[model samples]
Target: MGTEHRTDEHRTDEHRPDVDRALKADCASCFGLCCVALPFAASADFAINKDAGKPCRNLRTDFRCGIHTGLRDSGFPGCTVYDCFGAGQHVSQTTFGGTDWRRAPDTAQQMFAVFPVVRQLHELLWYLTEALKLRPARSLHSEVRGLLERTERLTGLAPDELEKLDVAAHRRDVNALLLRTSELVRAEARRGGKDRRNRRGADLIGARLRGADLRGADLRGAYLIAADLGGADLRLADLIGADLRDTNLSGADLTGCIFLTQPQLNAAKGDSATRLPPELIRPAHWS
Candidate 1:
């Protein structure tokens, strides 16, 4: 993956303080390594267009994006929606000691490799911490605490150690604990006993489902790309790993859809062609 290093200036300045503070606390010291490490397509999502390893044209000497203010208007709307959940800075400054891939090209690759590993750990931390906050998930508290400690330790690994880390094994262990936590929480949430279609891997591409009742539906790994799901009721829906590419969700209610992240959402397509919830943003890919 070829990506150009960018400064923090490309990121949204008007971030929600609660989120910004948490993300910053976890990752403010590092530079924008992900932008330079990951590869992106020349879709509407990016402005000037770049290769995977190439630094963005707007990147400045200090590693900030020159077009930060105009990122949306300039055609890089996708960048506006991306949040590493605090992975970049943590790896750049803390794990790598404020060093950069430029000064040490070899280390840049290592930094890039360590980021996703840490981000996944952090994402789990976010969920586990949230689970602990729920009264019903109390039974899983001890397990969650243990997972947090392990996850935290992984996040703090040095670049060399992090690059050599076995992230998959850790994820497997974390998944087991998360599964137990999920079951506990799901059992507590009251739901209507409706005989809904449990379509775990249905191919519903481009199918019209406007204003459809889909409460408590199981759509795991389903290919629903380019399907019209406007005004669809998706309360308590399980959408894990579902291929939602080009799915139209205009006026769709996803208030309780679990495990949906900005990256997943961005990878899927939506537009003025669709009306997303206020909380979500329009990815450049959709344009």
Candidate 2:
């Protein structure tokens, strides 16, 4: 595989902090941690069952995917949609001091164990950074920035410490902050006379929400797993921390869907008919 190139033109403006770089996946700077550390079952997304701590069959010695550009055609569509939020590179270059797991086989287990924890922390940082940018959440911006700093610090923990850390507890604390931010932002729609749909952390499994107008709705931490959201209008909706697994988004217009991460979209079920923001690439399994 060839080296990947990322131009700074796609980066945030000068007014924003440098955290955006750390929140974007940089595969070239990574050690293919996601390929080796994460397990995947043979499903619609993945063609094969890969055990945790075991390197993927297509991972090269240089820590690059053998079928990088052709992952979807090669039956590894799940790989193409994954984003570590720069945790892979941080684990490779900083956490482990540039030591390849192949060269230091003894450190493999610990490194693999630490990767997911760090990945979770990095994910929080990604959302917090996004929240800080929302003008409506300006009152919470200082706190969001503080949480972002703390989350970034958590990623830099020693491997043993990282493995021992209770990441779920950390996520709980951050989710609360995100929920507050979502409420503040979505309040605008309520003031505009739109329905005040506060479905935060609700069990919406298998709910019928077709053609529902959810513009600027606070959907943070909502359990939308396998819900039928076909043709739903989710513009300007805050989707941070929402569980989108198997959610039907066919014909859904998410043009201004705020804080909707790529991983969330990847976990959901959508089709060619689904509309998405320009920043989000359509999922391969949607075909």
Candidate 3:
């Protein structure tokens, strides 16, 4: 998702100056890498099928979407929910030094190949940065910081080096660390309670869970698509990789929830009553 100007209230401790600016999408400073480097099939979310390295038809000469304001109305809702975690600008300006694929035609293939790799690394940086801000995960801060720095360095590597890097192996290492952080934070939230739900990777699609008590729940990688989660108490829940598409989050309290990204919120349904972590803004479509 493109970055918006957030007020002071939206700037929480997780959004400290050190890493906040680096983890947000800045479309103005980018060369529309996402529109050209990523492929999308003609499904419910996209109006047309597009291949990697080929610019979307809506892309303008200035590298902005021609139908950005009416993306959803024009049958390109998927574009509204995609976030590159700031990799687009980093790749366009830093990796390739502001030379767009159109100008440097010879570098087009390598630039496309390197964008996704940097996107993944930047995502891990997002998680590691948040993990460092969790007071309950204080003991693991040093390790998280180390990994965050290493991931930042990886993002700055030359395109060829990044293409050859084993990102999957690196992701495994980062996931393990994040799991430990999740355990520490969730344990603290459920210290005096006995209802510790371990629904990690559970298939709860279309389940009736309105008004459910899901505080401190381990819901990592759960398939919660189209689930009724209205009025649920989801504080401190581990929601990393959970499919929240079309899920009802109206009136649900997601304060302090871990690993909840803007794209996930954009895909789900919510209302003004839904409470969110300070770092994330309510999606405009939620209204």
Candidate 4:
């Protein structure tokens, strides 16, 4: 679904406010960490490459992108696609007690380092939370919810603790769970519960798949770099960890696509004719 349809992570009919905040990006309450804590290269997406921890040239003292309204026209189209998953605001308000980098320059280095770590944890939360929402994956709902709670707890760790956290190890663990969940949901996408095509970890870079009926295909971790998916029927497809970089999604229908993150969408090419899952902002680079 688009931008993760928000729902309560209820264990016993209680609304978990903390879990709700873990999924969406609250940019206004953030320190513009994506524009500063992260780096960019001087490509079509950016005017120049910026080093990590260095504030972007277009960043203001107020911690907002100065060229936000005109990012695409201003030669920094990449910025328009970055989503921090609420890690920025949580790092600023909760982790560091609302002390920004400018006001407390001494903490900048450590803050920048921890931003990415928490961001990964939050991204996992987004996936795990969505996994719980799938009716076809009902068998794995308990398992997914458990992982979601643990990932949420990791988001609240102290700065020093978070700095030392092994994020890749945790991501591997979550990936295992999501893989099973994908299989469960995608199985039902086929008529009479037939198995979907399992192209997990296949190298399909630049392969032509235009107008292909790929509904419910298991494309987990598929290397689809630069693959032409124009006009493909991708409804209910499982795209968990699929490398969609440089892939053409122009005029392709992605309605009901599963585990399709914004980062994946940002990496791919698409035009206005592309039918996306609701709430996913179309990339401006796509004409």
TM-score against native, each model: 0.72, 0.83, 0.94, 0.86
Lowest summed lDDT over 10 consecutive residues: which window, candidate 2?
1-10
Q: Can you write out model 3's per-residue Cα lDDT over 1-287, one digit (the tens) per residue? A: 11223332212364346577988999998989999999999999999999999999999999999999999999999999999999999999999999999999999999999999999999998988888768788888888888988998999999999999999999999999999999988886677867887999999999999999898899999999999999998988899999999999999988878999999999999998888887788888886
The residue-by-residue lDDT of candidate 1 on 1-287, one tens digit each, is 00112232112222224433444323235566656766777777775556656677777767777887888688887776566777777777777888888888877666777877777776766655544544445767777777877777778877678777888898778767755654544443334565767677899988898888876576767889888887788755556657776677656666555445556676565545443323345565564
lDDT of 2 by residue, 222-275 (tens): 999899999899877888878998899988877656889998898888877788
Residue 71 lDDT (model 1):
81
Q: Runs in model 3 with CA error above 4 Å?
A: 1-16
**In lDDT terms, how accurate is model 4?**
0.81
The CA lDDT at 6 in model 4 is 35
Off by over 4 Å in 1: 1-21, 24-29, 43-53, 72-77, 103-106, 133-136, 184-191, 243-245, 265-287
**Of the pair 1 and 4, which is ahead by lDDT?**
4
Which residue ranges in model 4 land beyond 4 Å of their true spot?
A: 1-21, 190-196, 271-273, 279-287
Local distance difference test values of all predictions, in order: 0.64, 0.81, 0.89, 0.81
Weakest 10 consecutive residues of candidate 4 by summed lDDT: 6-15
| Per-prediction backbone clash count | 13, 0, 1, 0
Candidate 3 contains a number of clashing pairs equal to: 1
Which number leads on lDDT?
3
